[model samples]
Target: MDTSKATGNNAPRNLTKGEATRRRILDAARKVFSENPYHAASVRMVGKAGGFDHPIIHYYFPKKAGLFECVMEEHVVEFRTFMEHWFDGLDAYTTDKGLAVFIERIIAFHIANKDLFRTLMQNTAHVENFDQFPASAQYEVFHDSFLKTFRKKVHHNASDEEVSKFVYSFTVLAANYLGASSTYARFLGMEGECDAYWDWVKETIHYLFLPRMEKIIFDSESK
Candidate 1:
């Protein structure tokens, strides 16, 4: 399946020569951290991956911790944009438009940038446990935004306590479904195929969320 255009999916661009080099270094660091454990990733390795002579990461970033922090910052911005789009798109999800767009966006992201997605979502534990985690602040911001938006969405259906329950349940279900793709691929039957998976995600969102949301809002308004 189209391996082309795959290599640079995680890379960030748009910079002057100096800024370009710095961006490349950050991309390299993200690549390395996603493949191996973040604790095991090295600045020298990241620098070399970006076609540098030596530990030039030190030149661009003072310490490995700082470099990792930059990587985390980049991811935080990405999450912000993604969440913004997700929220905006909700307005577009209508009786006519359907949930296909929303499902496709999430599934496409999961497949295209699996490593980046995994690193950001999976490394929550690492950030939580580290005493002096460099990326903690960045994650906290995104986490807050996610919860705020999530709470708003759920409160449209349930009480405060119920909204909290739905938030936790919804997030857990989304995470489990997205994260288990590798396993799901093997035995998901027909829906495991990428195209079919998109269909499946659409159906899940429609069946699990939209019916209840419509009942609570649209159905109420109509009544």
Candidate 2:
């Protein structure tokens, strides 16, 4: 019998040397790709950042596109796990509180994964054939998972289109705001005051978007 299909071995295991090396290369690639557009980034740049020879990087990811795809898929998986846990927590909350929790946790996530977010945004804009990329499927999974969680926890009565609009609007607002953190901080005269900048982000969301979101969620519930 094939025991490989069993869940008994699902316990955490340490990375092998090769796995560790690959992780290092992916990390370096993520940082490099985050800083530069895909066209401007190179495997050599990733090698320098990761302290590996370019050939080693090639061995792990023969094509730069493949490396980018791995990086995106890794980030998407991380985000999906986060969303699942986050939605689990929201199950016990009222919609108003759920919205607040959603905003707060999402901001924290954006701040934590800012680099991945930047890479995704930059490459998405520059990659003319993004729809054809293998990573695009991972993005679709992430999107579907997100919408599923949102519907399950926040608005069960909402249509996918309605939920998508809410999700899209919130993501656009949050991503652009957090992605340009420095510029937003400087423009607001809160430069060097990171706490103040984040606080302002929360305030801005509450004042600008939260009420409309609450209305929508409640409207969906009432319907």
Candidate 3:
């Protein structure tokens, strides 16, 4: 309701009762979207999930699209903060060790937030007009800086194209693995062993992928 407090810098501050209600609606929207496809998720569902009246949700977000956008914005803010914290000590470890640690943290984060990641991957994979979403701009800004930071850690001989491909491939692999962990676990006869599956993933990446990557990077540099 208060446009003055809606600015990026001022938002999410100590909220009045009304703003708190808005927050609840957004939180509910997130869960609803995560659990359902975009076409199936509805304002009424979000209202029921949040335990608020439909009118309250409409007052904050006039349409389902608006509510989805707000939910995405909130997720983007939270994810950016998490990534910044995760990359805090990037320079401290050896390159291979640092990358292995980074990958482990990423897997851990995905496992912890599997539903959210599933929603994101599904939306991006299915929505043809994904660029029109409000979160696209935020993602572009975050992605540019993310690649820049990754480039700095990579071997200087690695081309931008190579780095881009690496990032894209790694993201897809991690997201898909965590998002479909349950299905994969069942298929592999390890149903309900989510903890063990995650450990195996981390170890596989650390002992196998990390060594291969180190060799590739150094090999390229030597060439």
Whole-model lDDT per candidate: 0.61, 0.71, 0.66
- What stretches of model 1 exceed 4 Å from their correct place? 1-14, 89-100, 111-115, 125-131, 150-157, 187-193, 201-223
Relative to the unseen true structure, what is the C-alpha lDDT of residue 104 in candidate 2, on a scale of 0 to 100? 70
Model 2 alpha-carbon drift over 4 Å, by segment = 1-13, 91-95, 220-223
- After superposition of all CA atoms, the RMSD between model 3 and the true structure is 6.9
* Model 1 error, position 186 (Å): 3.5
Against the true structure, candidate 2 has what lDDT? 0.71
lDDT tens string, model 1, 1-223? 2222222344445668988888788778888766555676777788778888645677889888888778878766665566555544455456324344544555665566565555655565455576577677875765566677765542254465655554555555555566555555557775454766656655776578655455543343324
Q: What TM-score should be assigned to candidate 1?
A: 0.70
In model 1, what lDDT does residue 220 have?
39
Mind giving the per-residue lDDT tens digits that candidate 2 earns over 1-223? 1111111222235989998889889889889977888889999999999987889998889999899889888777677766665654564666666666666776677666777567666656666786876577776776677767777766445566877887777766776677667777899988643878877887787677656665666565434
Stronger candidate by lDDT (2 vs 3) = 2
Which candidate achieves the best TM-score against the true structure? 2
Write down the worst ten-residue block by lDDT for model 2.
Answer: 1-10
Question: 1 or 2: which has the higher lDDT?
Answer: 2
Ranking by lDDT: 2, 3, 1
